[model samples]
Target: MVTYSRAALFILVVFGIGFAIGSTNLPGAWYAGLTKPPFNPPNWVFAPVWSVIYVLIALAGARTWERAPRGPGMLLWTAQMLFNFTWSPVFFTWHCTGIALAVIVAMLLAIIGFIAERWQADRAAAALFLPYLAWVAFATLLNAGIFLLN
Candidate 1:
């Protein structure tokens, strides 16, 4: 039986992986060259918000994994996670905002599907994903704004 503490630790590890991937040799200089939208948040805001969201995402995934180890739900979770990890490299390092935006849309769809499946297995897991979905929806708008402005 997985204790709540163990699950929490697993979530933290997942969040750390995401944070490390996002933080490594980020292209801050490259970002200055792009024409961001007028409403773009400052650079600092992104790290904190994403950190919290990633933790939530990890928790949601862990909950689902506990309930259903291998299934369509897990596959969708993995697909979205892969997409999530790739977005930083595409946007921050490669400066491919347009491509990243497209990938993010795909990621959003995968998460929606994952949540739909998880809703049946564990409603808390599905609910845990709501903030992530909301943030991604906001991010999609932001990405579109950046693409248009830049």
Candidate 2:
């Protein structure tokens, strides 16, 4: 069983790092200048959505860690996090929409992989990732839109 301290640590590390990266790589003039898709959400929408998703992600990670620390599920979780962290820097900082699109796509795949890898062994952990998968799928479309429009 995962202790509360372990779960709290996972949540803190995951959300804290994601928040820091987001704070650091904000969309400024460059992003403002880009032609966004009609489906693109307002800037304010991202924070709340991501905040919820990050908690879900952390919970899933903690569950995965407790069940299969060195298994494929954990690997996929780590990959998704890396890809997740890379997206803002690639899109906002480097200003590479095309590369960011690719990054987001990879992230989406990693999310799916994590779900599949954990579904049988830990259905709860896999279920926890469903929202992340959905959001990233939408984000992938948004990224593709931005890349194509620009």
Candidate 3:
């Protein structure tokens, strides 16, 4: 049985922490000056997209935690969240695109690992990660593009 309180707490923590970190480490003049790829979405699109993604991420995490707190799925979920939280600071504040790319790649890998780990045990958790994976893949390309161009 899923615990509503635990799910709500995970959702709030995931979304709130991500929003706080993102708001604090927003793209500034440096990001604006970079030559972005044509595929890059407008700056305004990120917040809403992330808002939805974070909720999905939280739900998957809560479900995985419920199923097996100490399992590989939870480990991958934690790994991805750590990498996710690290990217904005490295890319926007510290201005380390190469390092940020590395972080994001690791994050992408962790997300894939999470999905694979959850596939047999919890298909819903795995399904929840599909959009997150797609977005991160696109973001990885964008990061690589920016690193190459600038």
Clashing residue pairs in candidate 1 (N, C-alpha, C atoms within 3 angstroms) = none
lDDT of 1 by residue, 1-150 (tens): 446885787677778778788778385877777787777788788778888777777777777677677878778888999998888888888878899899999999998998898887778878878988988888888888888888
Candidate 3's residue-wise lDDT over 1-150, tens digit each? Answer: 568987898999998899899989989999999999999999999999999999899999999999889988899999999999999999999999999999999999999999998999999989999999999999999999999999
Best by lDDT: 3
CA lDDT, candidate 3, residue 61: 93
lDDT of candidate model 3 versus the reference = 0.95
Name the weakest run of 10 consecutive residues (lDDT summed) in model 3.
1-10
Could you tell me which residue pairs clash in candidate 2? none
Candidate order (lDDT): 3, 2, 1
What tens digits encode model 2's per-residue C-alpha lDDT throughout 18-79? 98999999999999999999999999999999999998899899998998799999999999
Candidate 1, poorest ten consecutive residues by summed lDDT: 1-10
TM-score of 1: 0.89
**TM-score for each candidate, following the candidate numbering:** 0.89, 0.98, 0.98
